[model samples]
Target chain A: MLDAAIVLANFVVIPALSYGSLLALGALGVTLVYAVLRFANFAHGDTMSVATMMAIYCTWWLQSLGIDFIRPLPTALLAIPFAALGTVGLLLVIDRLVYRHYRQAKAPPITLVIVSVGVMLILHGLSRMIIGVDEQRFFDGGRFIVSAGEFKEWSGLKEGLAIKSTQVIAIVSAVTLMAYLFYFLQRTRTGKAMRAFADNEELALLSGIRPQKIVTSCWILVAVLAAVSGTVYGLDKVYKPFTYFQLLLPIFAAAVVGGMGSPVGAILGGYLIAFSEIGLTYAFKRVAGHLLPPSWVPDGLLQLISTDYKFAVSFTILVAVLLLRPTGLFRGQAS
Target chain B: MSGRDRVYFVLCLLLIIGVGIFQSWNVALTMINFALISAILSLGLNIQWGFGGLFNVGIMGFVALGGLAVVVVSAPPVEEAWRAGGWRVLSALFVAVLAIGGSLFVWKRWRPKKYGAVSLVVFLTMAFVLYRFLFDPAVLAIEKVNPALSGFLGGFNLPVLLAWPVGGLLAAAAAMMIGHIALGLRSDYLAIATLAIAEVLVAILKHEEWLTRGVKNVTGLPRPVPYEVDLQQSIWFQEWASQLGIDGIEASSLTVKLCYMVLLIIVLALIFTLCQRALNSPWGRMMRAIRDNERAASVMGKDVKRRHLQIFVLGSAVFGIAGAMMTTLDGQFIPSSYQPLRFTFLIWIMVIVGGSGNNWGAVLGGLLIWFLWIQVEPIGLATIDFLTKPLHPTSPLRVHLIDSAAHMRYVMMGLFLLLVLRFRPQGLIPER
Candidate 1:
């Protein structure tokens, strides 16, 4: 029983944690944009993909220069800071060229959304133009640091557990970043100014907080988060440009399902969405069998649903949340 | 006519003639047809957005439903296929609808303790069993029938023109249902809902092979105009072409395309007239008032929700007619070919560029933007080719750069949109 639990933990729980961490970072980007920009930046997903692709390319270039990491962690980790810087520059340019006019005009929220849609297409086309519409997996490094066989035998258990070393790195990096962000927001003057700006933009402006600086800072932070999250997710899975674009729906769902403007809510919502997607799709046949008596278990009812419908599950939760609490659980202002 | 109007008119004519001279007459005519259809789409959106200020990001869904209406109204019925699995499919649909309706009733009517807890479970269990019972067998039966030509039930054998209005009605009905639930929410939420639902609608169209032939695509849809080949073969056409001092083949093709262009223009004229009348009406005034300020209108006893719903349905109807015409022009109902990126954004660009809240502006925008969309690709390719002329034929950089220019159209479109929004926020023909 304990062995099976360990196996389940290693496979399901650990992966979920990694995914949750990644989604939390992505959600942070989205939530920050919603708070500061006061519109859902649909192009963020594609921007993330572009940043990660840059990092992957740079990592390959660096590795060719014989700058190899001896650890099991992917070399892309070393390339992420450079990727974040590149993304920050890219975002600032987009803001200056495309979004600044709309912001100055004080367009309606929907017009801004339409502008963002245009931005999304431009970014999407740019990414595809540069990278081509192909899945690239350039992050493969050394083998597992702690193989499942080693852990199972170490515990003297019947079922073996596998924990990828990259997964460990992802969780730790995410938590550390999130911690820094919370500290920055709570303890720093600039972060307080950001919060004050988000709380009421007009008031913030009246109080002499420079809107451009705050907006620029928000975009930079969002760019860094998006780049890190995208790199980690691409490393964990595979990076496909279009897949990231499609992921806008679920990521937005996560951010909105929590409250749009609340950073903590975005994190919570990410994990909630991740768990529902994985948990609902997971067949509990083995788990049920372990818990229940032989005769009482139903044959096919153990499988909640096929994983192909995982998107449907996220959408369903979003709809349910919207129907029940339109303002979201955290009561942020509606867009 | 006013000097500005005359000037604008002259500019438009010159642009059209230039397009005709640069491209073939047939290609130009095809662009005009697409433009007219897009005009109808933009007009529909204008009613919702420009008039009522409702954000509907699910135009693609309503368009697909409109196409489905064409299939249902015009395609010849597949008798053998229907006999094989029609009853099963019907039963599945019936059970699904009943489950949903029953659950709604239970939730709304019952005051029992913990009823909410059990109601959802009961509804789901019933739905699953009923779905599996009908779905599995239906799939087998559908496969057993023709398996290739007509593996699913086909449409009613009616005149193809009937599909247009029917398409509008179908789309409007779907819009009404969605709007009824989603209209009360904030605009951003509506955007997300509509976008998700449109994706769902597309998924259904793709997965439900028994209905839409899935990804195989239903083709050879009936056309309102004669085929160019047939025109070429006609003796009357040939004689007229020779009389006009033009090559018979080229004349015939151009004549057939011109016929299609006229038909589209007539449709556009009819829709434009109707839309213009509606926009000038009291209802239109009310919609504008609501759009400009919803709360104010609501306080004035305008029934804001109902008015929004009305515009939503009306706009969806316009989209439906446009969808039908597009499918008719293509002579196919390729569900997979319908993408949000292409269909949705193009129409938006039309509405925004032409001038919202003005029917004439919408049509003009539609025509101009459609022309630009088609022309930009060739222009991009030409520029890339010119730039890469110095490179070797097999050079990777040249190949990569040349291929990448195809995506430059999107960047151009985005730039165009941003420029329009910034410099001329009121559009080419601002609403007077």
Candidate 2:
């Protein structure tokens, strides 16, 4: 039972929390874009990765210059602000050059998706061309902050849980960022303008909300959030170009599941998806062992499915949700 | 068409030929192969998106399944693995199909006045048990066979060329299932659903190793083109090449490649002619009318969903055929090799770049963009090398930059796509 609990804590809880945080950040970007831009920005994932890669390089540069930061933490923390600025510039330029034309044309939603697909390919190409296809690991600073064994001793439990320092930082930062975002959306004038536009674009326009400014601000926020999310995720795991491309499905899933344009729903959806993915593949043998008699305990781990099928869990959930509740649980907006 | 129009077409062809001259013949031929496949894919997309205005983002899934269809159709059956786990796997599939059919039947029979009130739970609970009962043991038996290689049942060892049609059939079948359920949904919802389905399909291809050979990959597939080695050794070819004052080996190799190019061109010409005829037909005009205004068309008495389904299936079949062609050309089936960017979105770029509504434009775009996709890597590398030529021989940046240049093609291709979408959404060769 203890062994099972330890594995659950290490694998299920931590991954769920970490991945949830990452998805929340990614979904925030998605939601913000949908609200202001009124189109799904497919290039957002690669934009995140590009920002993270840039930040990672800056971190390395800063380190080489002997301008090191706090121990046990990544240097990307300090460089992220600059990375966000650069990414915002890139996105703004792209918007002006590529998306502005489409906006001017008053293209349909699907056309915008096609245009975004083009943009996504360009960004994908740029990232690959600039960075190369190798899996670049930026891990160097330190190891685990909360050792599993120590947690076991402190809790006075047989099961010990290991939590990486980055995971802790990720969760904390995600919460703080999300809180600030909610406050900004709920409290600020521009935020209100953004929401009004999202709610009723024509009405909001008639009410005097400047569409361009709102759109620009949305891009800035999205860039920052994407940078933070991508960098932190790269730090937590590893940055791979291909993985970012594949991540489009899940990130979109989270956005759709959370109810597009709803921050709270996006956050909730992220956690829901993360839990489904981690929990589905998680074996209940150790957890189940505790409840069952010795004679009745099953042979082999009682895993519902293999870990390799993790993505399937999210897809299944998304399909089921869409089939049952098309607008999602919260019904925040037009899917 | 006017004489000037004919002249312009000739000019475009000349430009393509000029570009091909600089690159190796092998590269040019490879581009032709990709172009044919992509044109077929674009045609499929044209039916759903171009003709029906239905958003079908699951092109990747259909194409991947089509690729898998080739493996399922062509590769020699591993009798031992089949004996080990074939029935179990088939049962799993059977169970899933039955569960789905049964659930739909139940949903229809109950006809609950309010959705999400009661019947949903019943459907889900029954589906879950049926799925688990079928999936779990089938997976286990397959795993028990080899786990590492050939764990799954293999293919039918049929003629490789037939795989193309088989792939199309499979994609059509899969698309019908998806289209039936999703066509009524909003465009965005349909897109999301399709995207998710594609991911699931790819996942199955990657994990269901017993069938696909998984990550180990199935290679050396039978080819319509003569093997390069075999061509090099043919006595008649050597004598003919010597008479022509060319190296026999080189001549024969190029000959084999040229043969492939001819075959691909023939396929493209056939498909293109067929599409042209279809577009001119009343049926095609109806599709376009439907796309331009679905509600209006439906009000006029055309069954919108049914029409959309036909286009969707037709388009997917084209993509399936192309996928099979790609597999045959490579003479290998690599489940892990499929990427949305490489397979799905890249083709989208080709179609958009070519001219979505025009078959000729699609083919042109297919060929041109494929050429650019392959050439951009070399172009980037050469530019970087030239720029860094004066730098230290051992400079780390030099090596890194040179190495990194390989990725520039993706960036270039993407930029090219955006530029085309922005500046010439109609494409260089606009549909007449």
Candidate 3:
């Protein structure tokens, strides 16, 4: 039973928690834009990619300059702030060029969304052109926080549970960032203005909230989120442009599931989606073997669905949430 | 058509002829064939987006379903795999579907009755266990029959042309299922939901080895037109080729492409006429009314949701037909080939730039955009090479720029799209 518990924890819990954090960060960006801008930013994934690509180049440049001062952790950690700045500039320019036009024109939200699709294509092209389309692993940090051998020896358990340093950093950073975001939204003046604008734009404007300033601040925060999440995710796994784009689906799913525009729900929805995705597709033959009698061992892998169906799992949960609770768990202001 | 539209078409023809002059007739013909397919896809999208104001970005999914329909229709059945475990596999599927259907039926019928929910849960658990018990073994047997060659159940060996209509039906069905779930909500929900469904369909295609051979791919689907080798072997073909003063091989391939073009043009004209008629009809006017103002149309008792659903299905069917046509052209069904950027967003650009509400505009956009989509890489590459001439040969930035120049087309295409959206929102050939 203990062995089974260990296996379950090793396979499902830790991975899901880390993955959930990544989704939370990505969803936070999408949610913020949806709330303030009143349009689903289809280009969020590509924005993340552009930021992560910048981070990757920064890391390479730093490594070349012999700036390996952060020995135990990835040097890329230090490069993230620079990437965030670049992202803020990119997004602002995009907004000024593309979105600002539609916003000024008083176009419908869907039309704005369509413009974002065009933006998505441009960013996608830019990222590919700069980074090239291949998987790049830039993590030169300590490989593991808890190696399977170390755990096995330390605990004297048959099952070995390995925990990577990247995963730990990802979860910790995600929590830290999310905490700061929550604090900012709940307590800060600018955050309040932004929230007021999102809630009722005309009323907020009448109440002396500067709409342009609020939109600008929102985009800045969104850029920060996109940069941090994109880099953290890249650090945890490898950076692939297409993979980053695919992340848009699950992020949207999380944002929608948690209730769009609700920060708390984005976090909750992130973990929900991550747990369900990992828990459902994970094959349990070994874990089952540990618990069951030798004679009653299962012949098959005991997986409900295959791993390739990962995207489908996210969609299923999204659809189910839409059907059962259209507004989401936290009662977000859904379209 | 206006003189401006005529000019646009004439320019497109000149461009094709120029490609034929500089490149080859084969390339030009290939361009024309694909442009027709793209136009068909654009027309389908224009129906949903332009005619009915539905924003569906899941064109890739329906197209994939159409491609899948081709494999399911034309590919010969793997008899050995079938004998090994096909019936058993079928039965297992039947049982699983029945269990879910039965549960839903019971849930709906006795929602107010005591113990209804409990009974449903209890019944589902047993049903699932029984299903896995039956399904796991059958799948293992089928996969073991011929893992190298024919591991999965193949299609009904039907005529290739038949696959187009069948593919359309399949895509319509998919659109219906997806629409039933997503429609009647905010318009954006349809966009996201359809996007997710498209991804799901592609995922199913990529992984379900039992269905369309998964990523291994189903190739060499029997062509409706004569094979080039057969044409080369015929005595009369060689004489005809000599008379035409072209090589037998070159002439035969061109003949095949011409045949394909004829067939594609026929289908394109048929769809264009249908869409043109629909656009001008009372039905089309009503769709435009709903699009322009849904609240007013609903107040007028126009059944907005039903009409949206209707157009959504019709458009998806058109996408599916084009998908099958594409598969026929390629002579294979490669599930991995359906990328959202190419199949979904690019087509959206075509429809937008072509004048969404006009059939001729769509065709013109299809031809023009497809030409650019094909030509942009080369153009970008040559331009990059020329610009980078001043840089040293071994410079990393220069080498990287040259090597990655192919991606510039994306940037160029995006800029073009943005430019059109900003400057010419109505597209090159505006609807009358």
Best by lDDT: 3
Model 1, B137: alpha-carbon shift in Å?
A: 2.8
Query: Once model 2 is optimally superposed onto the true structure by TM-score, how far is the C-alpha of residue A3 displaced, in angstroms?
Result: 6.6
Badly placed stretches (over 4 Å) of model 3 are none
DockQ winner between 1 and 3, please give it.
3
What is candidate 1's DockQ? 0.53
Q: What is the DockQ of candidate 3?
A: 0.77
Give a tens-digit lDDT track for model 2, residues A1-335: 67676777788988899899999889879878876777777877888878887887877887788775576677778878888888899889988987877777888777787778777877776677667777877765666888878888898876678888888878988998999998988999998998998889999999999989888988888888988898888888888888887777778788888887788888998999999898989888877776678899988687777788888888888887777777776785664
| C-alpha lDDT (0 to 100) for residue B109 of candidate 2 | 69
Which ten-residue region of model 3 chain B has the weakest summed lDDT?
B184-193
DockQ of each: 0.53, 0.64, 0.77
User: Candidate 3: interface RMSD in Å?
Assistant: 1.2
Q: Tell me the tens digit of each residue's lDDT in model 1 across A1-335.
A: 78558756865788888888887888889889889988878787888888988898888988898787654567888899999999999999999988888788887777788788888878888887888878998776755667878977787876777777678777888899899899988899889999999999999999999999999999999988988888888887888988888778778778878878899988888888888888887877776666678897767645566665667777777777877887777887784
Q: Write the per-residue lDDT of candidate 3 for residues B1-432, one digit (tens) a residue.
A: 898889999999999999999989999999999999999999999999888889999999999999998999999998988888788878888999899799989899877999898989998989888887887777777777678887778899999899999999999998898888888768676678788889999999998787788888999897889999999999999999999999999999999999999999999999999999999999999999999899999999999889988999999999999999999999999999989999999999998898878888888888999999999888878888899899998899889998788887778778888888888988988877
TM-score of each: 0.92, 0.93, 0.98
- Clash pairs, candidate 3, are none
Candidate 2 residues B119-216, lDDT tens each? 76677677776766766776667667765656667788888778888998998998888787677777777877887888888888888776787788
| Cα TM-score of candidate 3 | 0.98
Q: Per-residue lDDT of B1-432 in model 1, one digit per residue for the tens?
A: 246645765676677788789876677777777877888898888888777888887889888888888888888888887888888888888888888888787777763656776877777797878787787688778856776686768899788888988988988888888887778888888888777777777767776778888788887767767887888888998888888998977887777677767877887888888889888899888889898898899999999988888889999888888888778777788888777777777788888888888777787778788877888888888988998899997899989988887777777787788788778877878877
- The weakest ten consecutive residues by lDDT in model 2 chain B span B1-10
Q: Can you give the lDDT of residue A30 in candidate 2?
A: 84
